[model samples]
Target: MMNLISNAFLVVRPLEKRNKLIDEYNLIIEGLRSKGINIIELTSKEHLLSTKYLCSGHWISSLGKGVVVVYPMSSLGRQQERNDLVFDLLGRKGFKINDVVDFTEAENEGFFLEGTGSIVLDRLNCVAYVSVSKCSDEELFVEFCEELEFTPVIFRSSYSDGLEVLHTSRILTVTESFSIVASCMVKDKKERKMLSLQLKKSGRDLIYISEQQVENYVTDIKQVKNDKGDSFVVMSKSIFDSLYTDQKNTLGKHGEFLVFDCREIERQGKHSIGSILNDIFS
Candidate 1:
């Protein structure tokens, strides 16, 4: 679980102030840590920015039980950001990573699959939702599904203006009990219908959002439980505002909202609140 956001960001260079992003990221980290979310912040002097829509911190995933999946990024420069040193940092932080599944080899074949950005894993239901894009490839996606034994639900997230969504996390988010997705995230009606039906059949309540909210990153929230078993849905202030009253009401039915104003990072990083959170399961 390495955090690379508080330092490096490749978007909005004009209005971006490193100090502001640092302050906001620190605040978010403190808030989550208070709620018993174990986090490790990896520091690097290089101003490396990986993918345009993908969070640098989200370039890899802690797949629980000492296994991690390192992604094959489209940016060659970003690939250099993660190396032996990064893994060593995680090891020092008590992330017992005994095995690493490297997906970077696909870069030679011109196929790339970003971690978490390419696929949204419904861990409990054994399902995965992926948006087809340059950042996500079907071949690499199927390999990941087979490795995890998750049923893959393929869809193309296209906006009304004829733009395909780049990151799956931007369009949908799933938790243990529910999922929030933008109706316009998937352009294929049949695929969308299948996803909706599958989610419902799997016993998850759906909180559907609009394309506008998806652009605002409202659905990229993360649900976590405190040591006392209190549940919270963590999100940025902007995302919170983007939600409809009924949507907030629906979330309230499931968990408390941990909202903070992270406009600076959200704008420049193009990421939501949970974007920086890296979970290393015990």
Candidate 2:
């Protein structure tokens, strides 16, 4: 119910290509911490072969309600990233990790669901908007929804280049009172109407973005708040810089803006600010 982020956990990779990502992660984490937010660190190790750098492992939102749910990694090397050690570490930190859902067997057969990145969660409304792609499985998504007591709103969202967008966060930005969505990627008019209706029913204003903006990953944003109860919107510098003055002003009306440089991390093409964010509940 709290739109303000008080605590978060970030996962980082130590690979050379991802070094900048760690720095960017640190930058955002530090910035949020400076505002009195608590941050937990989950550093990836070499032994976690299957889980190391895959987006699936870092999609922390799947483990909702402060319950850490580990998804079965499809990639062999990536599976190691979901080592029991990480879960134990979180438990030691006092995080309430419910059951770890093992979909490894299904993953081996090609079924997959990449956590919060693949599906955008409207926590307040108990709805999950999922964009089905190679990394997203319809059956698994339904099962996940059933488990979490969420209603699944599934659709396909593709980029202008004809490639399916990897994560829902790339094209959809949900806030407390408004949701910034990339309508261009949502091809089905009927489905789009349903999505719009759902947002309206949930008391959210829809701010539609063009395909051009989505292509540049300019629509991705997250809402946060400082300790004093002052709300802020956190986004990559690229997204912030690309926003039209009007769009920026509209967002400003909602809250203060906090932008972090993420070019190097984006270049690595694996993680984003949303991927590594795990909500910490006390």
Candidate 3:
């Protein structure tokens, strides 16, 4: 099966950045440019002086073609309609905003799902895989699933500190052929088995990674096609180094690997390749 078409991105330019941050950002920009992907960059008007996570991909989620979901961020600084500017930019680009969930009240009611960061969508199969975390509320997730007509597979996974993983995408990515996941993070036996079974049911090959690899941001990668319609997987050099030769060989059968040096960006807020690349398909 062909993977989701990812030819465009909606990125937000940070208002302030150090020299190293600029270098890292340029590397990602150049890397995508080399692959012939469109980059829609907008400068953030509001200054979040203390926050390092200013990536727009974490706040907006595309439900499907021509429609998108603007999430109520769980982050204190990212909240209070901070996502409107990015959504406004997207609106100008001809994307219709979805109102399936009451975003305005969701945050007041203590429910938050940080777009694609909190859940991984199997768009072809209409399934949303989510890990229950501080940023992902189970009740709201169910409501979203019902309204959006997506099957929600709820599971729980955490970091070594016993804190919930900030984003599910940091540990799991569901693609057409195979899924990369840090199963070790899922502490429970039955839930882990259920997640595996569900992926198998959806006809995806499971590629398991160690917790260390996940820490290295191995699962935080994006799959897209180049301008000539050739498939390519975009990831950081850290992710490439963390992978075993066998894993790389297996992934090579699916797409050409394009690696970038994003150590500086990742160091700031664990935001790397996938977190900044918001796919806007045409």
Candidate 4:
């Protein structure tokens, strides 16, 4: 229950994009390393095929004790080859990965999970909040949840125009003591109430954010602890700035803020700091 991650994976953005992002990337690495987190930098030969947001937490979800589940990207090309390169890199770094589900198989069947992005995991409570989207297949999600013995709290989230939320992590952040959620994004009253009651039942305070806050990446935050058991909440500077004083105060009760400048990363990649840092549970 320490909720401390010993390692994390970060992909080197494409060469053309790295020029503007190297400084921020290094800063993030320095920030995480300072907190006793080992950083695994992924630099592949097939960097071109790497999605702009490939380094995000969405690509892989760790099931603790060195097990991981990698999801297939719906529209991304050469996903298997890219994943092979990544797995090889991880293997060389001494990570004995036991994939619960094969990405290739899922891709062949046109099912995609998008890893942690599609699901907000309350690991301590053994619950997972999943919002159905193109990146998350309902059947695949249920099967994966069953494999891990996690109760799947499935819900639907879409905009007025019927545009689905691409990732659950974008609208919900489940920390140890509390959850930052954009309940407004979930239009269904029953599902919204279900999400609310579930969080409360888990003994977590719900800090609901507006749709505008979600657009500012307010939910893209994560809580982690260092070797000494010092807890910190990691987030982008933009998200930290966007928070109101009361929200900051509420979140501060749980952990100290560990903010970094990732505006370019967010702008170019369309993901926040939470997305870029995938917790390595091994």
All candidates' lDDT scores? 0.71, 0.65, 0.76, 0.75
Model 2 CA lDDT for position 49: 44
Tens digits of per-residue lDDT, candidate 1, 1-282, equal 222112111111211336787677677777767776555655643556542332544467766667778888877775665545657776776667778888889989988887777788777667788888988898899998898677898888888899888778888887767788886667778988977887778677799888888878887787766656677888888888888888888888777889988887677767776665555553
Clashing residue pairs for model 2: 48-80, 49-77, 50-77, 50-78, 50-79, 50-80, 51-78, 51-79, 51-80, 51-81
TM-score of each: 0.88, 0.85, 0.91, 0.89
Q: Please state the error at residue 160 of candidate 1 in Å.
A: 1.3
How does model 1 score by TM-score? 0.88
- The clash tally of candidate 3 reads 0
Which runs of model 3 end up more than 4 angstroms from their true locations? 1-3, 50-52, 91-102
Itemize residue pairs with steric clashes in candidate 3: none
Residues 1-282, model 2: lDDT tens digits: 523243444445444445665676667777878876555565566644432263433334434455555564445665555545666666777766665565556676787776666677777787888887777787888888897777899888887678887667678866666688886787888877787788778877667788877755665566765557677777788777778888887788777787888676556653445444554443
Name the candidate, 1 or 3, with the larger lDDT value: 3
**In what order do the candidates fall by TM-score, top score first?**
3, 4, 1, 2
| Candidate that beats the other on TM-score, 1 or 4, i.e. the better one | 4
Q: For candidate 1, give the lDDT.
A: 0.71
